[model samples]
Target: MDLDLSSAKLTQKKKNSEGINTQILRSICVKTYRTNITKHHIDVGDARPITLPPYRIWSPKTDYITQGLVHLKEQNIIEPATGPWAAPVTLQPKRDRTMRFCIDYRRLNEVTVRYVYLLPRIEDTLDALHDAEYFSTLDLRSGFWQVELDEESKEKTAFVTHDGLFQFTVMSFGLTNAPATFQRLMNVILSGLKWRCCLVYLDDVIIVSSAFDQHLKDINDV
Candidate 1:
């Protein structure tokens, strides 16, 4: 039941060191194995890890994708378009066999995708940590789901089921616009702080100056 991201050795890394992933994933499986054994009160003979469903390709054509011509282009971003008029192509999910997962939105470039994703600047994050000798960060586990959803939006935030019913939880992380909503919340919480002072990256917020008194006040303010 756990959708743990830490099983991989070097997630989000451009290139992973060989053999590192196997060790890390094995360690995660061991922990999951141990936890389930203890929780279910399984006998030594009966306690064995169950087979996980293979990582799946999830982009089963949705009605959400739109087709439009890109008036401008980049060289490596897409195959060069020779003609004036371009026919719409059905986008296919790209599966990385080594990663054992499907990468959504692979047939098109991210730049052309209409959806805007703002990656937090690593330099800005580092700059925020300049002065303080100590740092403490707070993260709400499954923070998106923690927030209550409005009734109207809740219905649309759903998935279709094999049983013919579509289902949704309050507000899940995998939703397309979750990042922007989460970013808004974070910005509101730390609005006026100097870039060299307190900093926030999505659900993670940290105080650069870590005095007990100041920390308590900041938490209260947020």
Candidate 2:
């Protein structure tokens, strides 16, 4: 009798899973996501661009960095920069024994104005999930790259490398106000459904519902 009951439970779980709309929970396609620009702002008085010397990269990593840059250029995320402002690129080691490309934006961040947008508190976000039975989480792919930078702001993001100077057309990691900008965009896009059935923190989105049907509706709304 117990075995029969367990099998029934498993069958019900499978049925519930089949009701979910997986595509809605996945990141929006890059082409669609990149159509809109999310400009990063700095105080007018503190907007002077900073230029810095290029840092040395290991010889073996040059090929990897070049390939990555080529890929980014092909995708229109970056272009060759010709401006006075420049930052240095630093390749941080990743867990998979690969290098993660990053810009050393310390000097630029120090001089730039700060955004005061408040992120949702962790406790508050968790508390709102009370009684939620059906949950789905979505992560935006290359989240920051989805939002374009303003033309002037793009020049300010110029970075130096062995290849040459380049600037991002879209938002990149390590900018001081990137989190706030991304959060602001998410809040804008998910305005109506947020707090009611969804929670967004940067690139991560969480959807909650008490039933599978309601979960489908919430996912669609997102």
Candidate 3:
């Protein structure tokens, strides 16, 4: 359901004390739930893929990297790739002491064309919520993985592991233009409701309302 409400008119037929109409609010919810949002994809646009040699990994972390590759493949987050471009992988230590698999895409970013949508300023976002009587924030789990990558751009994200080469089928962290792509998608999904009852910054969605009853309705609509 591509919630493209460009043609739908959601005029409020009546209003409550807070100037909110339940009928219109329900319409907003229906549109949001039915609209099928597009998945995220890498857009190098006019830039061509840059060929680079894969970097070597630490000998001690070889086993971890191999295990991580197997897990990602099992989850369908990545698949075997035989592309000319191969970036190196690194293992970062997490709070639990487990190795966090990461791909170094610095070189690729230099040549990757960027998406130019402007993110909202921090001050402006805060000002919007200053007078709100109720607020709620939702964080998207594995946010990047939620957005799928395009087949054409998957080859450009190929990375080397101890076992073999693989590429992400979903958006991965460290891509230069990923933030812009995500922000653009979020803006589109929240088209009618954005700046009216909510504020979104990447994976974080904040819903604000001036009354308790209206707050609950806003959450459901968002």
Candidate 4:
């Protein structure tokens, strides 16, 4: 009985070690991307402030929205806005039956100057992985929030709520050039590693390698 227990313990230890090795690159240290409003302008060309009528919220959703706003405020991701611009906030129902706080930025996107940066061709990215055998995929948590918006551009994201007006300090979803900006950041971060052993598409990162040992080394380098 003792021999069996000892063997089981060794097997569990091996499994744990393997798990740690596989997840080594999962905790990559990346710096937050900051939007250069001075260099890249979001021109709202003659488009007046779009103040959509406020949407009514029921009991639990209202509480959830308030809590969400408070959490964002605490994280310094958003702050009270006194700007003339105001977009109405809405609660998008999640699969879990919870409310997702969202701002209707359609009008804002319409007037903003579109970014023309070309995204990577899916076929090209996939073709490069033909030689790869081992693969590990990673997803950034709240990826958009990892980017900071410039002071001038923050006000442009101002939204109205029952609590008051608020603007994002970090880049929020629904912005026109957000994906392009994120892709640009990813390209910059991956630099020389891209098309070599790493494939990046916005917040998703896939590390590829032809051999297991090479995969471990590549993941560590990333």
Best by TM-score: 2
Tell me the tens digit of each residue's lDDT in model 4 across 1-222.
Answer: 001223332346443545555446334433333444322235687777776667787765688779889988988889999888888888888999877898988888988989889889999998998988877677777778878876778888989888989999888898989888888888887899998999999999999999767876777777
Segments in model 1 whose C-alpha atoms lie over 4 Å from true places: 1-119, 148-152, 162-164, 194-197, 210-222
lDDT tens per residue, model 2, 47-134: 6678889788779988778888988999988999999899988888889989878889888888777889999999999899898987
Report the candidate with higher lDDT, 3 versus 4: 4
Error of 3 at 158 (Å): 0.1
lDDT of each residue in 37-120, candidate 1, tens digit only? 111010123222221222323354332221111211111112232222221223344464222111132211222223355757
Backbone clashes in model 2, listed as residue pairs:
none
lDDT of 2 at 97: 88
In candidate 3, what are the lDDT values of residues 117-160, reduced to their tens digit? 88889998999998897776766666677678877888988987
lDDT of each: 0.39, 0.80, 0.75, 0.77
Candidate 4 achieves a global lDDT of 0.77
lDDT of 3 at 150: 73
* lDDT, candidate 3, at 70: 78
Collision pairs in model 1: none
In Å, residue 124's CA in model 4 sits off its true spot by: 1.4
* Cα TM-score of candidate 1: 0.42
Candidate 3 matches the true fold with a TM-score of 0.78
Clashing pairs in 3: 1-35, 1-36, 2-36
